[model samples]
Target: MIESKRRRRTVANIATYFVLAGLSMFCIGPMIWMLLTSLKYEADIVTQTMQYIPRRVTFDNYVAIWTQSGFPRLIGNSITVTFLTVTICVATGTLAAYAFSRFAFRGRTQLMLGYLVVRMFPAVMMIIPLYVVMRGVGLVDSRFGLALAYTSFLLPLFVWMLKGFFDSAPRELESAARIDGSTRLGAMVRIVMPLARNGLVASSVFIAIAAWNEFLFALMLTTGQGSRTWPVGLQLMVGEFQLPWGVLAAGGILSILPVVVLFAIVQRTMVQGLTAGAIKG
Candidate 1:
């Protein structure tokens, strides 16, 4: 009976490995294809049949996209907008979340519900009104305008998510600090903030990723290279006569690099925060 049970366990392990391997292949197949296509020449890419492997690997597509297109400017704009949006969301959301989590006040539940509802509102519905307001304010074709719009859209989410994390935090830590002569604000900053570092990092990562990938607003609100983000710039690569698949793929690869790097850096903190919040809550 023990031998039979062991065999069953070994079979389950093998099945699990096979399933995981298949899922990994499915996820990575497109990325591998993109890399290979990016290295291939236009002639090879445009042929009737696709080439899984390129005869000649070259950085020419990357170079062309960088030098010929205004990719550098687009990258800069994306970075600027994402950075500002993340900073604003993190700052405002952290304070707002702490207030909601720690303090008791009238209409607090209503206010939190309001934030969640606003977050649920679709961005497409707000585009027309936002465009008009941006136009009225002379911010139609500006990075500042795009960043502000992204922050507004992202802040509600950050507030809701961070509030959950802050709610799960132990109140005793803050109370101890206060008992030791720390002011309320000082206790929050020095003690609570440090304890909630994982949540803060997770929220920041989400906001940054959102801001970086924002397309509709960036495309509509911004014009020309001055405020165009990478997503918009990448769309412009397809010309009337021909589409540059290699360049587009290279640009896509470049665009995702920062997000990949960021996740690699903060993945541990994000996982820890999310797990802690789940367990505590």
Candidate 2:
């Protein structure tokens, strides 16, 4: 009877794995198809027949698009805007989150909720006002301006996320550090932060992803390639009457590579951070 039960459990586990594997394939299938399409020849892409793989693969698409579309400038612009946004969000969010987690002030909770309301407003709704404001400030078509916009939208999220981790941390650590002559800020920076690295890393990843992929704000704010991002560059690849599917596919794959690599590299830390925070909470 025990052996029979164990065999049944094994079969159940196998079925679960099968289901999970199938789901994963379903989700990843489109991304896989894009990569395959990128490697295909133009003829393969334009063909009526569904071709999963290329008859003749070429590196020419990647090479041609890189310079033709001002991709290097776009990449630089994206990296700059993303990192700047992350920096502003992390620096400002960490302090605010630490304040919210560690201190008490009247209306603090209400203010925190207010920040969420800002995010609740669809970004598209904010575009017209944001455009007018940006125009007034002479920030249109500027990368720094775009970075500031992203930081505003992303900061509240970062603050709330970091606050969770901070809340999960022990207050005694800060108290002990203070008794040992460390300032409150020092305690937070030196002791509490090290313990909260997992959360910080995860939050940073989120900020990077959001900033990198943001399109609407970028589109409204940036008119020239001087400040255009990969998403915009990818969009412009489509012409009035002719769309180059192979080039578009190649661009999509290239665009996602950095975020994918970063996620893969730090996924373990993010998981640990989230799980540890959950347990503590």
Candidate 3:
């Protein structure tokens, strides 16, 4: 009886593994298709029946995209805006989170609620007003302006997420640091910040992804290649009559690579940060 039960349990485990593997493949199948499509020749892409595997995989699509599409400029603009936005979000969010988590001042709860409300406000509603304000401030068509706008929009989310992580941190560590000789700011920098690395990483990833993919604001605010991001550049590939599928696919794959690498690097920290808040709460 014991032997039979053990065998049954082992079979169940095998079945579970197969199910999970299948699901993972299903999720990743489109991405695999995109990569394959990006490498296929333009003629092969328009064939009668879709071929899962490319008959003749060529680097021409990538090369064409690089040489003809001005992807380098788009990539540079994306990196600049994403990096700047992430920096601002992380810096300001950490400070705001620390304040919200560590202190109890007048109207603190109300202020936090207000921030949440601002986050919920539709981007569409604010776009016109934001454009007008940006024009008034002479910020239109500037990378700095776009970064500032993204930072403001993303900061509230970072604050909410980081605040949860900070609240989960042990208060004793800060108290002990204070008792030893550290000021509040010093303790935060030396003790609290180190403990919240996971949270910071997680917040940075979120902010980077958002800023990198932002299109609506970038489209309306910026006019030329100087400020145009990858999304905007990709949209430019769609002409009046025809769209270059291969080039578009190549551009998408390239655009997604950095974010994928980033997530792979910080995935562990992101998971820990996300779950730590839930467990602590």
Error of 1 at 251 (Å): 0.5
Models 1 onward score TM values of 0.90, 0.91, 0.88
The digit string of per-residue lDDT tens for model 1 on 52-156 reads: 899888999999989988999999999999988988888788899999999999999999889778777678898999999999999888888898999878998
Those runs of model 3 whose alpha carbons end farther than 4 Å from true positions after fitting are: 1-26, 270-281
Candidate 2 on 153-229: residue-level lDDT in tens?
89999999999999988888788899999999999999888888888988999999999999999988999988998
Global fold similarity of model 3 (TM-score) = 0.88
Which pairs in model 1 have colliding backbones? Answer: none
- How many clashes show up in model 1? 0
Runs off by more than 4 Å, candidate 2: 1-19, 271-281
Question: What's the lDDT for candidate 1?
Answer: 0.87
**Alpha carbon lDDT of residue 196, candidate 1?**
77
User: lDDT of candidate 2 vs native?
Assistant: 0.88
Q: Which candidate comes out best when scored by TM-score? A: 2
